[model samples]
Target: MITTVTLNAAIDKTYVLSDFQLGKVSRIGQIHAVAGGKGINAARVLHQLGIRTLATGFVGGSNGDFILKNLDQQQISHDFVKVDDESRICLNIMNASNGESTELLEKGPLITEQQLAEFRQKIVLLGQQSRIVIFSGSIPAGLSTSVYAELIEALRKTNAAVFLDTSGDGLIHGLKAAPFFMKPNEDEIAQLTGKRPENETELVQSLHQLADSGIECASVSLGASGSMTVYKGTIYRVRVPSIEALNPVGSGDAYVAGMAAGIYQELPIEDCLRLAAACGTANALSAHAGFVKREDVDAFLKQIEIVQL
Candidate 1:
């Protein structure tokens, strides 16, 4: 089974409107809400892919309850530590006129020290039962940036392959644990290496730098241009067929889910990239975050091209 960690889980609310004006009232055309946060999103996609997945993280209050209920309704298994504070709500306002999206993110609840300890213990225990443990998204307030590093190190006793998808100091410190895989976008790569890559050559160089630091595989997502991945000193470039994207919010999480599914199945590295890219593209074609139709993935897979670079 694959285990996913979301330190700060949330209720994601998407509002669709014809136009959004600053300091003006706008009538909503539609509203969609779901259990979200990077790991939860990935878990949802994994479940859709027929993978056995368990989501672990911190949640509390009514929003937390809603999150858990939504997961159960979706038939996604989850075990989360209950906190005293309330989970956050993330709002996504989509403008129908020009397909622009505006996001308002909450900082989430503060976790107490006791709560943190409980989660650490729970994750390590779950890690033992998992073949792949994914640590994703942002850490809540009051947690140190080294949280992922500490948890990943604790999981070293288990046989689980760790996949990390996060940003900022979390990514920096998590690298010390040398996770099995990581997918960072261009800005995130720059955040870790302290240099923004200007072109494909520079991007590949950055990936090489990450591999030298002990990470086994690192993929840099290039949005519609597809992605570039480095695995065990070899580089591969992936390209995906373009389509009109309905919503690209959780595409990254979907990508992580596909890669995790591929690795868990012991597929070849090239095949893993193919699946990952397809899942990401499929998510973009859907209106919901972290959602993909199985048929879409299969069709996109045939169109995705991968070249060894």
Candidate 2:
């Protein structure tokens, strides 16, 4: 079974408008609210793929009740530590005409030491039975940057593989623990490596450098250009063919979910990237997070071009 941890979960609200103007009233075309957090999103996708998943994290207050109810409505199993403060809400405003998106995210509830300790205990117990433990998203305030590293270390002792998807300090800290795989976008790669890549060759080289530092597998997401994955001294680039993009939000999460699923299923690395790209492309067809369909992934997987780099 796959276990996903979302330390900072939220109620995600997405609004669609034909033309968004500042200092003016605009009617919203559509609005959506769902369980929001990287790990939860991955678990949702994984569940839809027919994988057994358990989501764990910290949540509290009436907002926490809403999250719990929503997960129950979706029939997703979860275990969360109750906290004092209310969980956050994230706002995504999508431009209907231009296919553009703007995100307004709120910092999540501050976790107390006692509550965090309980959360860790729950994860340690879950680790004993989980095959793949995915540590994703941000660490809320009051948690050390090395929190994920610490979690990975615990999961390692239990013989569960770790897949980390985070950025900046979280990425650096998690790398020290040497996760089985990591999915960082280009901007995150720049932040970690200091030197930025101007092209795909340079980016592959940088990915190699990161792998040299002890990371087992690394994939740098290049947005519309698709993504590049480096594993076992070989570099593979999966290019996303041009399509009428409806929404780009959650594509990276879909990619991570695909990669995690592939790793869990013991598929080839190239196949993993193909599934990753396919999931991402499927995500672009819908505005909701974790909205990719199995049929869409199957269809897109056939068209993805994977090149040796």
Q: For residue 157, what is the lDDT in candidate 2?
A: 68
Candidate 2 residue runs with Cα over 4 Å from true position:
none
Which pairs of residues collide in candidate 2? none
The digit string of per-residue lDDT tens for model 2 on 175-232 reads: 8898988888888888778878998778988999889888778899887889998888
lDDT of 1 at 175: 92
**TM-score of structure candidate 1:** 0.99
- For candidate 1, lDDT tens digit of each residue in 1-309? 999999999999999988888899998989999999999999999999999999999998999999999999999999999998999999999888888889898999999999999998998899989999999999899999999999999999989999999999999999989999999999999998999999999999999999999999999998889999999999999999999998888899999999999999999999999999999999998777889999999999999999998
Using lDDT as the measure, which candidate wins?
Answer: 1
In model 1, which range of ten residues has the least summed lDDT? 94-103
* Clash total of candidate 2: 0
Best candidate (score: TM-score): 1
